[model samples]
Target: MNKTRILDVKYALTQILYFASFSALMGYASVYLLGQGVSNSLIGTTLALVSIIAVFTQPMAASAVDKKVIKLQSLVNIILIGTVILSLCLYFFELPTMMLLCVFVGIVTFMMTVQPLFNSMAFLFEKYGIQINYGLARGLGSAAYALASAVLGYLVEDFGTGVIPLFYIIGNILLIIVVYTYVVPKNQQHLVQHEQQNKEETEQKQLSFFQFCALYKKFMIFVVGVVLVFFTHTIINNFFIQVITPIGGTESQMGIAVFIAAIVELPAMAMFNIMRKKINCARLLKLSVVMFALKHLLTFLATNIFMIYVAQVLQIGAYAIFIPASVYYVNEVISKQDLVKGQSMVTVGITASGIIANFAGGILLDAVGVYHLLMIGVVVSVVGGLIVFGSIEKKKANVME
Candidate 1:
């Protein structure tokens, strides 16, 4: 293989290793907490707190790259090692105290923001004639999630949820080694140039908040639509395990369910890459919006566990396409200097959506039940989809003008 291809492979492997364990932990950890006798409110609150902090931290993390505030690899190493230590420590703690332990772990892991950082790295690599394919690298993460999730499912079912802490310990250790040793090298050029450019831009442009809003108004509308879509989906994701457990699905089944969804993302994301060249992203996004709305609509009609399992195929269109497309599309409009802030805007939207989804989903589950909540998701998604559809047309009109 050529040099670029080789680097791409290495990059993909490192991300796969990094995200696989993390996704597994994310998909199953709440269940683990529940198994430990924690209440739903506590779990939701803990996750919300982490995401709220993460919303603030993402921009800071991206700023680290933009401003040369910290060594990128150093931050990853610290967070990874810190997560492992916290996991090991949690094993020694008792009931109510473990909730606090999860909270601490969430804070550290939440701040371990790398997606935008990696995007910047990829952009830098393009300048070096070593272009890293983001989608392919990201697909490896999906594959890792599939494998790790399968293992976690069986482990959770056979051993108990207590094994989760051990899994976290092992996973983060592997992540630390892969990232510190392989993905990031001690190269100063990307960081130095990025810092200098950001410094120049800061000196040149100091727009007021209102001015900044006006500057990104088009992208902002897109973000708002995407956020609402995310809000509806989080209703499903945040409570999926809780919804399935009572249905007699084993931890392995839960694993398989998430595995199925994550694996489906590979082909779905590939489709987006092909379609991006042929069709407009806004149009593609509308298709995803429709798909998700249909998905929840169908879910409201599902009766058996198998029906719910099958309905998740809709996730391919819902998350995989919508997310990457939104990111790539927004990049088209924003200045290079504002890339991190733009990406952070996307993250902030997601964080805001997640908070509302979790709190609202919890209440809906308490009031009407999971299936009924699917009906609510259906309505919310339709509204979000319509907003995107209108925005797409308005953008097209602006271009013509």
Candidate 2:
């Protein structure tokens, strides 16, 4: 193999392990919490707390990259090691069930938000003239998540719930090794470039909150639209198994559904990158929101496992179009200094909306069940579609000015 191909393969493998360690655990967490005898409300609250804290942590983590506090690979490796150790500690502590669950939740929450650090690293790689393809690396991770979730889901059916934690530990071990080895060493040239970029960004102009808000106007509206859509969809993301399993679907079936969803994401995301050159991303995003809105309404009416599976398949389009385009649009609209902060703001909005959705979703699930949650998703999704449509016109006006 050529040298470039080798690096790409290695980076992809590392990402696979990194996200496999994380996503597989997340795919089954709701089920795991249920097995541990936790209430839905408590689980939602735990997730909300974790995301709330992440609102603070992600920017700091990204800043560490800007400041050269640690090499990106080292930071990734340390976080993986920390995750594994903490997970093992929780497994062996023999504490009360609720306390043990809380500890596990906290650990996973912190580990999950290390996303921007990885993104910063990807950006750094591009800046350094490394032939790093972010989508392919990210795709491998998505694929790993599908494989792990499918396998573990079936295993849960046969071996029972006791094996879940063991799977988490095993995945993290693989993740740690990948992060520690194979990644390029930190180079001084890259650090100097990053520092220079940061300096120029700050020197240009300082933005007050109001100034930031003004600069953020159209993009912020788009992000807020995304947040509403995210809030709606999080209900499905978090509670899909709960919605389906009681309707004659088994754990294996749920796993298969999740596997299908993640697998569909691969090609969808891949095609999106290709399509970006041919289509205006904003138009694609508007169409995606429309499709997403339809999916939720379809989900609300779905009564069988087959229909739920179909709904999951439809979700791939929404994520593929909306997420990448939103980020690209935000980058186009914001100043260089605010790029990371701009992306982080989208994260904050999504997390904030998710907090509300998850808790309210739990209550909705209890009071009116999954159908009601699906109905709410349909409504919010339509709202998102409208915003996406409107943003195009608003964005044109801003550009014309």
Candidate 3:
């Protein structure tokens, strides 16, 4: 195959492996903890810890990539290896509760950092005139996630939650093989050097945190809107199993529900390039937030498991479109010198929201119940949607004048 075709195939395969690993952990980690007799509140605490650590880890990882402290592929490989080792340690050592929580926190911290690295690398490659087809690659990742969730759901049901770590190990192993075999080493070196040159050209001295904030004030407002949307999104994702279980959904059914949610993302993600051609990223983001609110509303009203599946169909607009749109929006708004930092800022929003969602969702899930918690999500999501809509409208109006 030609170089472009080869790179495209490698990128697609890498995405599939990356997301499959993510699904094995994030998709079922809570349910696995539940099966292990962990309380809903504690599960929330664990997830919150993961998000909190990720708040620090993602920015650090992004900085490392930008500064050439480590190559992108090298960083990814190291994390995946750490993940595999941690998964095995969690399973075999069967450590005390606190230690297990610590391991889980490490695993998720590493996993959360991976996406930003992938995104930054994709943009860097594109900047160098390489064609990676990020939308299609991300779509394939969603497809892999769906398949892994469904199959692992059944496996977890038949074998046990202990199977979760095993799946992580297997997924990470495949990811390592793909990265080492198909990924071209020279391309990575070129991307890293290019990023470093841009950084040095734009920044002779690193700005203080306050200086950086002042420079990106408008982008900071946009980040706040993104955080609000994810605040609701993270709640639903972390507590999805809890939401369905009270309605008689089993382990396998939980898998099916996630499967439906992820599968629907495929077509929307695959068509993101076309959608971007027709719709500006800001409008697409606004639409996504609105759909996010609607999805929560429908889930709040769902009385049966089937209705939950119906609600998941909205994932197309909510999550599928949101992912690509947000990436494009960041690239459009942020300067090249601050590219990695900008992407990390967006991830920080997501991680911060996840922190709130896990802690609050856990507390509410235990005190009130799933239905009541979902109602809170609906209210928050609508407010978030309005915030995003207003922000986008004001920006447009300013441009018109």
Model 3 lowest lDDT segment of ten: 392-401
Best by lDDT: 3
lDDT order, best first, reads 3, 2, 1
Worst 10 residues of 2 by lDDT: 392-401
Q: What would you estimate as the lDDT of candidate 3?
A: 0.81
Q: Please write out the lDDT profile of model 2 over residues 354-380, one tens digit for every residue.
A: 888877877777777666767777888
Candidate 3 per-residue lDDT over residues 236-349, each given as its tens digit = 888778988888887888888898999998778778889988988888998898889888888889888899888899998998888888877777766665666667677778
The candidate with the higher TM-score, 1 or 3, is 3
- Candidate number that wins on lDDT, 2 or 3: 3
Q: Please report the candidate that would top TM-score against the real structure.
A: 2
- Report how far residue 389 has shifted in candidate 2, in Å: 2.5
lDDT of 3 at 241: 84
Instruction: Rank candidates, TM-score, best first.
Output: 2, 3, 1
Residue 56 accuracy (lDDT) in model 1: 70
Q: Which stretches of candidate 2 lie above 4 Å from their native place? A: 1-6, 90-94, 126-129, 183-190, 193-206, 215-218, 331-342, 394-401
Give the winner by TM-score: 1 or 2.
2
State every prediction's TM-score relative to the real structure.
0.84, 0.88, 0.85
